[model samples]
Target: MTHFAPVEPDTATGESADLLTQVKKSLGAVPNMTKGMANSPTLLKSFLALSGAVGSGTLPAAVRERLAISTAQLNGCEYCLSAHTMIGANVAKIDGEELDGARRGESSDAHIAAVLQLSNTIAENAGDVDEADIETALEAGVTEEEIGEVVANLALNVMTNYFNVLARTENEFPVVSL
Candidate 1:
């Protein structure tokens, strides 16, 4: 494991402390990824801002969580997978089967499956998908607005996935497997 210890909420200072405090207030605890991100206050702030904006988009919470899980799995970030699995179950009400399916970039729901396909493509291809790829998503009932949000959500998840993988961040949430 990398020596990047998570910044403890109690000992954190400046912008990091304030951010960690807010995280605790919102989630009732500080997730380790956020703590690790706190090592760079600007990165933490940017992530929080992007998360809030993307989270407020038209995409359903379940779909967002599914995108997050699928992207994380594609990036091979175990910390993100574990954290998002808990959030998917507790907050999004995603069932075990759906959670498992998301990790594989599959979903029984057609809409979710479409979004996941786009999201996975964005993650794996680094947002370099061709026009036909987007047309396929549009044909599946994904609106342009929804596609935009999907791209944002995929980017956001990828940021965290890369961060955790690089930082070797500890998992504060329940452990989940691919």
Candidate 2:
């Protein structure tokens, strides 16, 4: 059961309603996570803004999804793991092996593996990763810009992971558990 019940799009008014409508139009559905977030329009908007900004960053869509999967797994957020697993395969076109690798923070591609390692370290250590972590990623040809974007993407995923966990947001997608 949800600690905070999701705000129905139909019953929502003002900014909440508007934002939920946009989400539905863009994604063709308002996910239960967003529905729960709709209770606070400001929070929902902030999430959207950050998500958009990160989406336009230097990392490729596949890499972003990998980072999300790694972070979600590290954080033990089932909702995020499920959502990103679906998006990673369907939208990002990441193959099954790569998706599974992401869940374990491993990738056959060296650069992607490096980024995933750094992201997992950051999430696990609460952003207190040591210099060696940076060195390893850099050595693997992970660009500085890619590193920065990794942090941004990690932040975005962490926000969603924490929120969904807190709200106990009912999973609408195929359930995935740690």
Q: Rate the local accuracy (lDDT) of all candidates.
A: 0.88, 0.91
Model 1, residue 29: displacement in angstroms?
1.2
Error of 1 at 120 (Å): 1.2
Q: In model 2, state the lDDT of residue 169.
A: 87
Candidate 2: lDDT over CA atoms? 0.91
Per-prediction backbone clash count: 0, 0
Which residue pairs clash in candidate 2? none
TM-score for each candidate, following the candidate numbering: 0.94, 0.96
Q: Looking at candidate 2, what is the lDDT of residue 113?
A: 94
Strongest candidate by lDDT: 2
